[model samples]
Target: MSAQRKLSSIGGGQKTHQFVDDSNRFEELMRLGHSDVQIRVVKYGEESSGRRPLVILNSIDFPMPPSEQFCDRMWRARFRVVFIERPGFGTSTPLPGVLLQSETIRNGAASMAEAAILQEVFRRLALEDFVLLGMGSANSVCYRLAMICPMVALAIFSNAVFNQNILDVFRPNWFQAMLRQTIQSRAGLQIASFGVKYRLRRNPEGFYGQVLQKSAGDLGYLQNNLADFERGAELFQGIEAQTIEYDLNMSLKPDSLLKDGLFETTNAVAFSGLETTDHWKSQLNQEAKRLSIDVEYAPNGDLYAPYASPEFLLKVITDRLNRLGAAQSG
Candidate 1:
């Protein structure tokens, strides 16, 4: 919530977005949870517009002040987007020692409770049809949110990691004192920035270049993404203690949500990276099929496939939204 990118009109009724940096919602929510935390939100599109908004709950790693590419896409599609930085990360307060008590992954869904707050924000603006989308790291929280808050219209996921028995991938001991030390350290921030910049420069195509290839008919779409990563130091500024913990606590459980009937959601669309682990998706496909919902793998992609397959991602989302929308209409 430190800074924001306001809307840039691309002509016609299509409009870019304006973000209210330093949203107070986080502060308010912190009081309610008794969890000393900070949260920042990047509001997109014209909030006043009577459009069905898209609330993108980003992965724990990447925070708000969204990529212009995402904004441009949302703008053109006539959808409003808001990316919020979870507590103890980004501009929010540091993670309290008590955070040391949760399932590590349970902290992942702490924001599920935040849904009530976000709902109030949306309502004040009258953006009634708000659909939720979650990226790789976000799928966990999104799952719980969709489960706990059944009022949500649809849950669209990108590279959902739950199909993997997260417990198999991570463990409590993984939250070693060393990792926590790094997250709270100055060196960790610099390291994260340099690391991302290095990756983007090395594979702009894989990082974000692959996303727009099918739609633009040219490789030029990557230029902006490349630039963002090129200035990775700035694009990835601010550290979130929660994000740091989320990464280290790899084995934390994210599927207990099923017992609560959250996954009973009849409307869900998932697009996963074919190159990534197929298990969580394998599980999702089975579950979706059993529930009569659709789960499809990207024609050809990886964990970052959502970026690589934005068009396909949109189609999946639009399809799910259509079904969910039709249900509401009926």
Candidate 2:
């Protein structure tokens, strides 16, 4: 059976498109390049909102920071948000065969396959046009999708990864190699799972603190909004051990989407933090220059700007969408 027909039956059309409780979101499978990738989609807000749907591209860590809160924030602004789970993240199927194959993961083939999957998603959802929101490493995927899927009317980026080489400069060279090997073996998965349990569930605060050190105030903010963290962690529930390995693997790969002039022809908006880690500064600037992206830097924002300054992020998004809508009508 074709993937579209299979998904239609699963969603039952009406049930598939209706607004559901947070816990009742639906997951469907789509065939992409010899692998069956899982995609869980949710439509937020009343259908009558008349706003273009928002499709969010998740990061390398796979839907980082839980999206329930983010979705709520968008929905409240009358935008319907679709949270896409990239292949190898959450319930999605991992790449077929050993993911550690340097040629496949580092060459850009994996990213191309992922972009094809996004194209299929646009067709299956019957999306005529929508806003594209790319978070973290997912920004690369979003950029690739925009190139292939014309249905994406606008693209929004948040702390995106334009050049992996810049990011690699900050990483401990040994750790990257070790992580790749660990994700390719069964025994390694078991060990990684044990580590994830301790970090994500047993002591999430400690885990988050280390990652949010540049945004210490944001970490404290998360402490008060722990529910968002808990929900974001759900994206990695069963796959934490594999997610890091896969994300890093992709990071090492060449990015065709970040090439010069890629975003010049597209309508896009970008946001980053003046307070972000020193490592990301050069990368952000280079990416912005390549596409002529005017980045809106937030004083109190960092990598966690999506969660730390939801109001600011939402305002920028909402205002841009409004402009797009008005332009379409005019």
Q: Judged by TM-score, which candidate is best? A: 2
The superposed Cα distance between candidate 2 and the true structure at residue 173, in angstroms, equals 12
Which regions of candidate 1 deviate over 4 angstroms? Answer: 1-38, 64-66, 100-127, 166-224, 230-237, 240-243, 247-254, 259-262, 275-293, 299-301, 328-330
List the candidate 2 regions with Cα displacement exceeding 4 Å. 1-37, 62-69, 98-100, 168-198, 231-237, 240-243, 318-330
lDDT of 1 by residue, 21-140 (tens): 333111111222333333445665445556567777655434444456655576567666666555444454444555433463454444444455544434433445467777666665
- The prediction achieving the highest lDDT against the true structure is 2
Worst 10 residues of 2 by lDDT: 1-10
Give me the overall lDDT of model 2.
Answer: 0.61
Per-residue lDDT of model 2, residues 277-299, tens digit only? 56677777776887677677766
Per-prediction tally of clashes: 11, 2
RMSD for each model, in Å, please? 8.8, 5.9
